[model samples]
Target: MFCYQCEQTAGGHGCTKMGVCGKQPETSDLQDLLIYLSKAISMYAWRAAELGFRKEEIDRYVVEALFTTVTNVNFDSERIVNFIKKGYNILAEARALYEKAASDQGRQPHKIEVIDSWNPPQTYEEMLAESQGIGIAARLSQLGDDVTGLQELITYGLKGMAAYADHAAILGISDPEVYKFIHEALNFLTADEGRDADALTAMALKVGEVNLRVMEMLDEANTGTYGHPEPTVVRVTPKKGKAILVSGHDLKDLAILLEQTKDKGINIYTHGEMLPCLAYPELKKYPHLAGNYGGAWQDQKKEFDEFPGAILMTTNCIQKPAETYKARIFTTGLVAWPGVTHIADKDFTPVIEAALAEEGFTEDAPEKTITIGFGRNAVMSVAPTVIDAVKAGKIRHFFLVGGCDGAKSGRNYYTEFAQKVPDDCVILTLACGKYRFNKLEFGDIGGIPRLLDIGQCNDAYSAIKIAGALAEAFDCGVNDLPLSIILSWYEQKAVCILLTLLHLGIKNMKLGPTLPAFVSPAVLNVLVENFNIAPIKTADEDLAEILG
Candidate 1:
């Protein structure tokens, strides 16, 4: 079980025995095998699509299967095995489609012996053993680190893209071209193209290209469903009532749960990435959709234990459930933990029951508040003001200091960096990383709040759109703006976003808490040369350079 896909991998390298996120080696191996099968399925799926046959269910399953393997998403080996078993069934249908398509075209299908004639072991134990042959470590020796690293880079980016794609699909928005690229990408991994450094690098950027579209699809799905987010202050203090805390990135699930729990004496509080949901017009109308509960995913163990009501993890970034609150914490939509309640089909009856059975806050905590909802639309609405302020030298610079937050040590760099920003600059942030100094005051520059939370990692499209607008306003490229991007990444969604930035030729961004272990030194050199990407220095040191 060699997993180095996240920033928290052991000793800044691979996790061999257990995951820093508490994933067991068995689960890790199973996830590896599941990805292998997905690639096999895609081998046929991609060919079938080329031959004019497509299956939406097969395409969607591949996306969800990849998302399930993302860091901290699914830890249940049984759940992963179920996906593997299901993949076998999907593979059969995909191959059948390819055969039918080829027959109608008056040609025989090309035989890819690697995936076509393969059969995986059936039992869980055998499946785990089979994973031994399919894991990334097995390929590292054969292909060498540089090529293998680039392949893994593409896979990681696809995992992030798959996550965002699934979210958009849940809201009834999707693009066949996105699915096509996904299958084409997974299929790319099964062939010789993955070993070419130049070809793999290009494929990685294409992953970014399509991911940009996926994020746009998600942005549209979210805003089209719920009206654009408005600048609104949220109650950070716990109210004196039964409550259900919803975490993870799925706004649709939260909305359904909000509708289910309305007037049932349960206040729905958003946690972590879900915090931005409070600003959406459609969701904010539910009076009981209370304020945010916690800061980010890493603090969930303590936060979940202390919360007196039910907790729901709607998507990724799930940790190993603690015994104290495992019973009350539920997971849905590709997130799973062993022995924890699993909510399927958007049902919240069990969650509501758990929330009511526990005592909520006995008394209202002191009224504390933080303003959220500074999405692209909200920020751009004040474009004239912001533009005028920047032009007048009232707003000196722009800093995008945001990405996935984790429990690593160097993450404090983001906090110190944000805190050290001068009074004249505006800091744009998104994802849970904003938790570092979000609650702290940055005050305002010319009536524009110095700290702007752009929404979840899913709202990166909003950030990109915001930058494009600023560039257009300034009559220059985004790179020419007085903006510095400092990102802290922990997971695959961040990977895809970084790829998007690289794809757009955005340069000189700082990325940490550490560079990915999967990126070989050669690949890192390429990034350094091409994009000027740098591992972060000390907060004071980095701040001095950026401002200078």
Candidate 2:
């Protein structure tokens, strides 16, 4: 199917034959149909809301449906088909309400087409054509081409927003407004009229604004529930015996694993985005939570190859598993693979059993440590001191050098940028982008480490929080602060986060290593003129630009 919703879309255009992320043509077709059904459901929900329908009942379903379409999230065709059917069922219920209302008003009831009535593809070419057709049709017949592009942009932003919202929900936090915007925006995408480019542009900005709120809600949920992250040193060294490597960005899953494995003689190490989990007070309370195992998302195949214990992926960014580590790998939550054992909603018992079955390190591994726990709360507690240091020339500059990491060679710009920063400056990083140079010893400014590892990509929430607080302390706008955001993006999550930054009027940021393939030059011009966004240059050159 023709899908270009991600950075690795085939040939930087669209994945026509098959998804480079291991999604088959059939799976792509199903995902398209799922979106179609989700749009139909959104339409019904929107109408119901206008008629004073109970919207709360359908909130969670709206979040889940949007999240299911995110890049690299769900590849299971069977699971997607089930969701499509579920959406249809919900739409049917809403239709019944509409019919009753019309009959009571003495008017003829209108009929709605069943979601299942849409033609399913019989061949690969048909699937591809259908996929493109649906996207184009949504843009033309519903949202005109430009508005369609903007709506899709906002929809993708909402997908990221829903993922974060879901994470907060797991932590027992809920924001009705976040869900409200998501539902409204999804409905707008499906609307037959009032879908002009200007209107969609306004909605796109609104999505970004609401996303900021969602991120704040999640940040509060995480820090308030788990205690703010604190600076703690984690080791990069792996032990010789049985060790289990945990990856992805879910702190709750990591916390449970740490709790269950306490005093069980099994060593736990953080991997990927989980590398920053060591900063959270509630999670770090466990004594056996070992050091980090590997670098970023791109390095997993090689790193997982020699890992001696079972590896658990709690979320996305999982590449094709190597044969050697296939049996040792496990997936949870929305992440799934064909042969991998998926830990379901009820329990992670199977994953724990597998970890236990594989005997951990035979001997105590060498003690090595890497510093973590530099999220917003931890940083804000010391904001006044940071401001004083900046003024006194002890901390000359602040660099936000983070974003998604990928296989592209140009990503080395991040490593070099981190390396070239003045000794007096501090580097703040989050997401997989930090893997480029997290291992480098940037030394300390006073007691604070020069390089701070904020949480995951979503933890951009933390970075934003810290920036705003710092701006407040300095009695100036956030853009007036010493910090500069040098970001590398490879996915839609990054797109949403960047949009949030732009929506907040944050300017003069550097984005790289390559521009998004989906951004038409016209749209790019608007971003450049309005946001002052630029691609990353050589480290020395960028350093001069920022420091000068």
Best by TM-score: 1
Q: List the candidate 1 regions with Cα displacement exceeding 4 Å.
A: none
Q: Which stretches of candidate 2 lie over 4 Å from their true place?
A: 50-52, 55-57, 96-132, 136-148, 192-195
lDDT of 1 by residue, 42-82 (tens): 99989988877899989998999999999989998888888
RMSD each, Å: 0.9, 3.2
Candidates in order have lDDT scores of 0.92, 0.77
lDDT of 2 by residue, 1-548 (tens): 66666776778766778887778877777777667666666666655555545355466777777777777677777666666667666766656665665666666754445433655544445544566667634454654445555666777787788888888888888876676567678778766443666676677788889889888878888888788888887878877655788998788988888877777777889998888787788887887887788888778999988777788888777887899889888888887777787787736666666677876667656776777788877788887788889888899889999988888668888988899899999999899888888888888888878998887886888898788888888899999989899998877778789889989999999988877655666667777898898877888988898889
Q: What TM-score does model 1 achieve against the real structure?
A: 0.99
10 residues in a row with least lDDT, candidate 2: 136-145
User: Candidate 1 — worst ten consecutive residues by lDDT sum?
Assistant: 112-121
Clashing pairs for model 1 are: none
